[model samples]
Target: MDLSAINPVLLLASLLVAATPLLLAAIGETIVERAGVLNLGVEGMMITGAICGFAICVNTGSPVTGLVAAAIGGAALSLVFAFLTQVALANQVASGLALTLFGLGLSALLGQNYQGIKPPSFPRFDIPLLADIPVLGPILFRQDPVVYLALALTLATWAFLKFTRAGLILRAVGENHDAAHALGYKVIRIRTLAILFGGALAGMGGAYISLIRVPQWTEGMTAGIGWIALALVVFGAWKPLRVALGAFLFGGIEVVQLNLQAAGVAIPVEILAMSPYLITILVLVIMSADRSGAPASLGRSFHASH
Candidate 1:
């Protein structure tokens, strides 16, 4: 293996790019779970967003439009789950699973013609002065706008959940929906909104994959990224910064593995390819060992009875 072939600076930048999708999805899922709703259809929503974004970009030749379309598509799909779980009071787990199935079939059908097609590229924002700095420039100052947006969202969500009144209400609802209901907060309305937000963010992440990461439309292109994002939410214990850290960690591993393979490293290609998933499982196991970081009411349905 040629050690010099792997540039540390480039490796870090690649990791950030790779982690963007997971960060976006995980942050969105974090908010949803915090609102006391568990939507397992993130994978479905993400792929649907991917196909929609790719298709729109191919048709319109605008990556921005494609991203917007992807968000709408993801939110639209989540509406199905929201309707079943929020309005119809259906089981959240089953409804989310169904949404995933629907999204998979829907994306496959929609993307049939789009297979192998490339989408417009997302624009990169290179910060002045900072981007020119040696070694650190690319790592810190050069990135797609979406990456910065994800970072801003992390801070915003953290502040919102920690300092804002609405955040308090949302957390209260998640912690005890019955008590929130007693206080006249509409639990369904809040949860529905959170679900929509989650779907949109996941969709945006999917669009990022099509527009910047993969740059092409393929069936099931998301390739379990949604599941990984879900696991990240847990691994981070529903915290935004920790979720981002987890994403970076996983992304770094993936990028390093790929680089090693490309550099003619002697490791098995299959093993390297599987490193991301393996790491995700390992992280989950270690986090589970602690058992104190998880939201107390995670995955439990909230019902209000008169």
Candidate 2:
């Protein structure tokens, strides 16, 4: 158990990196849920985005293009979800589960050719002045653009949900679709758009895993991060900032386990492997006491005729 082998600076930096995917996925899902739609295909969207981004980046040799392709791929898969739930009025849970199965299979097929290939290097931003600060600089300012984008996006989502008229409409619909519809807001439109946005973010998270996290294609590389993001949305009570906080916390623990393993900690390998998910189970258990209810219309199909 060589605890000293773990570097705090590296651990903090890695924490941000690990948390980015979760933040991106959770924040996007936060918006979707806020609009009163529950989509469970996050895992599927993420894997699809992972393969799409990896394939595009490999072909074009551009991480930027790869990320874009990832978003598009995720959104494209999500469109199926939008149609089934928002258009065909299918059960949200069933549709979302199907989406995951489909995504996993689709990614396996797409990634068959991409196996063992390395992705292009992603450039990190080392802010000249800020990154020079002792301890804090490397921890906070020295990060990839995606980390900052996830943070900025969370803030923007918070502001939008709290202050914007469109946000209000979305919230209104989430609280009660029938009332929002009585006021002439397009319930289905709002939810469809929200689902698309969520899917895109989930995809970006997936890309981060392939293009940045592991920098290589592997079967089912996203693991269960999507489901963790789902737990975060509820853990944060649908608040963007809270969701972000939860992501960081979870990301921090994930990094800790990795560092511990690297440090030759005496902990059982099996226990270390399950540490992150253990935290998730603990969080969910803690949340059982929370009275912060979900959006009133969440998971309930919205029909214009109704």
Candidate 3:
């Protein structure tokens, strides 16, 4: 075990990077659940985004275009869910599951030609002054733009949920859609918008994996991170700050596991690979102690009937 090979500062930076995708997906789902909608197609949307982003980036040689394409791809898939549940009045859970299945198959088909191909890299934006500081500088200031965006988005989401009128309406809807609808609030509209936003964010997360993390294309590359993001929403009790903590904690665990393997630990390779998921299961078991804070209308189909 070569403990000397691991640097604390580098580890912290990697954790932040590792957490970014999960954070983005979790935050997006947080918004969806806040509006009384449960869309389980996050995995599908993420993978779709991954392939769409990679395909676009490969053809255009532009990372920004690829990211935008990813968001569009996710939103498009999410709209299918919205149409099924929100408009067609289908079961939210079943529709979401079907969406995931469709997304996986669609992405696999879309990416068949792009296998083993690498996309353009997104350059990290180093802060002029803060990046030069001691340990804190490198860890916090020298990350890519998406990392800063994720943190800022979390703060913004917190403020939105805590202070804004729309936020209050969203919470009200999630707590009781019938009451929200009676009070002239468009529950379906709000939920649809939330679903779209969640899909866009999930797509961005998928793109981050393909464009920045691995910087390559592969089938099923999202690797179930979307499910983790879902668990994180529950783990956070639907709070943005708590969700952020869950994301960071999971990200840290992933980084540590990778380091352990790199350091030549004697642990079984299979066990080491399962470290993050194992921790997730354990954490979810512990966090499930109190589920009273979940939205009352969560996973329930909502119709205005107006």
Candidate 4:
């Protein structure tokens, strides 16, 4: 392998690009899980958002509108789950799975006319003084708005979960729903809001993919990134900064795999493509083995009577 063929700066930049979607989705899922709602439909929601964003961007010739539409689409899908879990008090896990299936079917139906179309490009923002620097300039300073937004969301999520009163109540609800309910907090309402927020962020991540990363429409375009994001929340022990770190790690692996293939490395393309998912399973196993930091009520349903 000609290691010199890989530019460290370019590799880092690619990692950032690949990591953004995962960061957004995982952070949002972290919030959802923290509020005692487990949504496994993230993959479906993301792909639906991807197609929705791509279609809207192509039709309107505007990436911004596409992203907004993606957020709306994702949130709308999540509302279904909220209705089932909150109003009907259905099983959270089952409802999430159904959401994924429904989103996939709906996105495919809506995207039939959008096949092979390219969406408008998202504009990149270059930091003033920093963007003018030599080799580091393009790598660090130039990126689409979502890249910066993902990082900002990480910090904001950390602060929200750690400092804000609403955040504290959300955490309390996740930790012990019975206690939070006794305290007069609307458990269902809080969880519903959290689920919607998660969906919107996940949708934005999907939009980033369609509008910027791949810049095209395809069925199941998100592949398994949503599942990876779910695993990342677990890998990070539901912490924002750690989840971001996990996203970067997976993103780096993906970038390296692609770059290696492009450079004519002897590795099989299938193996390289599978590396990201393999790593996700390994990380999940490691996290489960430790089992020290997982949210107390993850995947557990809460009822007022229980």
Candidate 4: residue pairs that collide: none
TM-scores, each model vs. reference = 0.97, 0.98, 0.98, 0.97
Question: Across residues 1-306, which tens digit of lDDT does each residue of candidate 4 receive?
Answer: 787889998898888999999999999999999987889999888988888788888889988888889988888888988888878888888988898888889988999998787777888899889888887887878877889889999999999999999999999988888889999999889998999999998898998887899878888889989989999999999899999999999989989989988887888989988899898988988898876666677667777887
- Superposed by TM-score, candidate 2 places the C-alpha of residue 265 at a distance from the truth, in angstroms, of 1.3
Candidate 3 vs. true structure, TM-score:
0.98
What is the alpha-carbon lDDT of model 3 when measured against the actual structure? 0.93
Q: Candidate 1: where are CA atoms >4 Å away? A: none
lDDT of 2 at 248: 96
Query: For candidate 3, lDDT tens digit of each residue in 1-306?
Result: 898999999999999999999999999999999888888999999999999999999999989899899999999999999999999999988998999999999999999999988787888899999999999998999999989988999999999999999999999999999999999998888889999999999999999999998888888999989999999999999999999999999999989989999999999878998988888899899989999979988988876663
Q: Which digits, one per residue and each the tens of the lDDT, describe model 2 over residues 152-173? A: 9999999999999989998999
Candidate 1 per-residue C-alpha lDDT over 1-306 given as tens digits, one digit per residue, 9 for 90 to 100:
897988899999989999999998999999999998889999999999998888998999988889899999999999998889877878888988898899999999998898776676778999889999998899978998888888888889889988999999988888888888999999889988999999999999998898899788888889999999999998998888899899999889889998988988888999889988988888888888775665556666666764
Instruction: Go through the candidates in order and give each one's C-alpha lDDT.
Output: 0.89, 0.93, 0.93, 0.88
> Candidate 1: lDDT over CA atoms?
0.89
TM-score of model 2 (CA atoms)? 0.98
Better of 3 and 4 by TM-score: 3
Clashing pairs in 1: none
